[model samples]
Target chain A: MFMAGNVINIFKKELRTYFTTPIAYIVIAIFLVLTGWFFFSTFFLFGQTELRSFFTLLPIIFSFVIPAVTMRLFSEEFNIGSYEILVTLPVSLNEIVLGKFLAGTVFVAMMLVPTLSYAICVGFLGQLDWGPVVGGYLGALLLGAAFTAVGLFASSLTKNQIIAFIIGMIVCFTLTMVDKVLFFLPESMLGFFQFLGADYHFQNTAKGILDSRDIIYFLSATFIALYMASLRIQEKQ
Target chain B: MIEISDLTRYYGDLRALDHISLSIKRGEILGLLGPNGAGKTTLLRILTGYLAPTSGAVTAMGFSIDEKPLEIKKFIGYLPEEAPLYKDMLVYDYLNYVAAVRGITRERKTRRIRELTDICGLSEIMHRSIHELSKGYKQRVGLAHAMMSDPEILILDEPTSGLDPNQIVEIRDIIKVIGKEKTVILSTHILSEVEATCDRVVIINKGRIVADGSTAELKQSSELEYALNITLKGAEGQDVKTLLSPVEGIKEVRELGATNGELAFRLVCDTAKDIRDEVYGKIKQRDWILLEFTQEYKSLEKIFRELTKES
Candidate 1:
């Protein structure tokens, strides 16, 4: 019970630490500009009112932004030796892991808020289906969370933020592109490889198909990555 | 109260602390004295529950560190050597955050912060970011954070390191005042600070406790005799040695050197005996001019070396 309270305390502290600086604003600004450009280019060239272009471009954009937000989560603590102070507090390991994960998730959620204007503009300017739009938003959130979890894990691997950021981006990019490279493999092995690809599940959700398997995949990835991050932190102690 | 039974720690195969056993009473100011790499930091970390021991058990306030670490942590405050602090946080904000995490009540958090701020002399820098502060100020902030919860056991590792002379004196004064109420354990390589501030001393070397006693008791238990350097005028080296050799309780006498019509000799005696008066009387009776007579007392440094040396 006390551990839960500490987790909430850490969560609030982590969130405040994030928003107190300009990192959150910078991430949101870049996300908005890049996503907005994709939306405009898609509308001008294809004349399509659908969010297909935006959804297709999101995995690529998040490959960069998620790493930026999570690169400092554990790396900064290690570099500053604050991890000693934190682990000595009357808090459990699970609380520490969950608190950081929730903070990253909240930041990702905040970044998605401004993109709502894109959906609003598309709805007013042309014929738009709300079902796929809702699904696309959910898919984008899950995809972002999955990438954030990977970034958190990578950040836990090193004390240098630059190294963490690079590792996170590379891991996210590889996961995002796994499906494309799996095509040359045999059909029997392709299915297993496709399950590892984040874009495969994201595409299903974006097409308005609520597959339980896709939901499980995204959640499992987030859970396993976070679990690995917690283990890494423990090993460092 | 803290009872550490056979506490041992290792970094991989290298032993850091070797089956160290000691008990500290409540409200006792204990100083951990050692040279660098002497396992002072390792023992403090284990006692504070920041690191687990490789073997043995530590029970603080009746709570085992391994069994109930949270309970132990609730009663202990730890300040590492470097004063771990978040540079981006304002002083007051950082203290408040620490207070909240330590489970202080919302009603008492503000009052406690103010009290610690005043006690640590942080009132002026409360609103400033930690990064903008000096090294002394950062140390005070770390101390304030540790004291926010009013913990019973305070573990400070090298609290005076990197501080200016004035700040060092100020911090020592603060520790003296706080030591009256809390069980304070501080580690330092400075011997004088231990003599001045610590009620008891635990001297460690090569990952083991070599000596443990009060400052005076440690100095006495060394059993090493004092050396008195005497400069005599109009006295040959053999004459000086012969006169001092026959003095009561005198162990040995050796002529060090003579310069400028002055002779210098070292007198060794039993530590529990005072042979100065006998030597003075004999020198006066011989009509020799006593140019200089200085007695060198047993220092903690000498005792430390004697205790750590191989038998």
Candidate 2:
């Protein structure tokens, strides 16, 4: 059983640590600037009242931004030899993995909070449907959650943060592109790759459909990735 | 209290800890003395629940380490060789966070922090970021972090390493104070550290317990005295070597370098014997001016060398 008290304590410590340092600030700043630039650059050019351009760019921009947020989560602990302190504590491996995962996801979601203004501004320009707008933010969170787990898992594989970030980018990019890469493969493997493809379901949810299947896909992916990360910690013991 | 039986750990095929067992009592400061790569750190890690042994049964304070690691961890404070401090955190904040993880209540967290600050001599720098502190101060903050939960067993691994001699003594005094209340397991390769602080010593070599006893007991057990240094004024190194060859218990003699014009000879003796009296009587009869004749005590270093070299 994963104790809520231990997980919360670990989460609080990680969140407090993020605030005390410049890492969260730098990451959030870069994410906002890049996403905001891409959103506004295409906002008026698309000229329709939809945030389609923004949500499309969200997943692509997040592939890089989420890695920056999660690279230090485990790599720093291992690099500085503080992983021993964490493991020797009374906390379970699940608590550590979840705490760090939630912290990174919440940080990315915090970065996404400012983009809500983009949705509101489009309302002033024209009649914007709230369904797709809300759907876009939900899509961002779901996709961020899934990518955060992959990045978190990558951080556990090495002690160097830069290598973790590179590995995170590669994994996230692969998950986001499994569908497109399947385009070149033989037609026989289409259903399997589409099921494995992150964008297939992500695009469906971004279109204002909150299908439980898509939601389940993201949740199960997050669970599996976090479980793998926890296994890495257990292996260290 | 802790009892370990048939504890063995293997890193892949290489055995890091052989079949060994020991017991620890409350309020006793035990020093784990061993050469580098002699499984000192591996044993401490097992005791602290950070590393599981490949085969063993370690029960601490009525709990088995394998089945109830969390229960064991609640009672133990472990400081690894690197000290495991978060360099980005302020000393006070790091301690507070660790307290939370240890499940200490909010009402007592502040008081515990204050108490540790005083014990670790961190009152002046509690507000300072860990990265800004010197290595000595970082070590102190690490000490405070380990003691945060008010644990019963405090395990410090090479706590005095990477410090100046003055800092070493400062940390030693703190450990001495901690040992007064809690059982302490201090591991190091420094022999004098055990002599200065520990009540019991366990010397491990080649992944096995080579010796275990008090410091005085270890010295007493080393009755296999080997060498004595002697200096002569009138005799050349070769002449002195020839003069001492036929003495009982004398096995071999070699020049121990020159000191001005006086010839120095290091005479190696057979086990369970003393050749000092024979050499002295012969010198007195010949009336040869003996400048210096002293046999160094068989210190822990010699015992460590002899035991480890044999294995």
Q: Candidate 2: which stretches are off by over 4 Å?
A: B224-296
Show what share of the native A-B interface contacts model 1 retains: 0.60
Per-residue lDDT over B115-164 for candidate 2, one digit per residue giving the tens place of the 0 to 100 score: 99878889999899988998888888888888888789999999998888
lDDT (0-100) at residue A144 of candidate 1? Answer: 82
Query: Top model by TM-score, which number?
Result: 1
lDDT of 1 at A65: 90
Q: Which ten residues in a row have the lowest lDDT in candidate 1 chain B?
A: B302-311
lDDT per residue, candidate 2, A1-237, as tens digits?
888999888888888888999988888888889878887887777789988878876777888888988999999999999989998999878888999998888888888888888888888998999988787788789889999999999999999999999999998888888888886888988988888878888888889999998899999999899989988888887
TM-score of each: 0.93, 0.88
How many clashes does each candidate structure show, in the order listed? Answer: 0, 0
lDDT, candidate 1, B1-311, per-residue tens: 99999988889989999999999998889999998888999999999887889899999999988788889989888888889798788888888889888999999998999899788899899999888999889999999988878899888999999998888888898888889999999999998889889999999987899999999888777776678878888888877776678777777898888798888888877777787787887888886788889998788988877766666
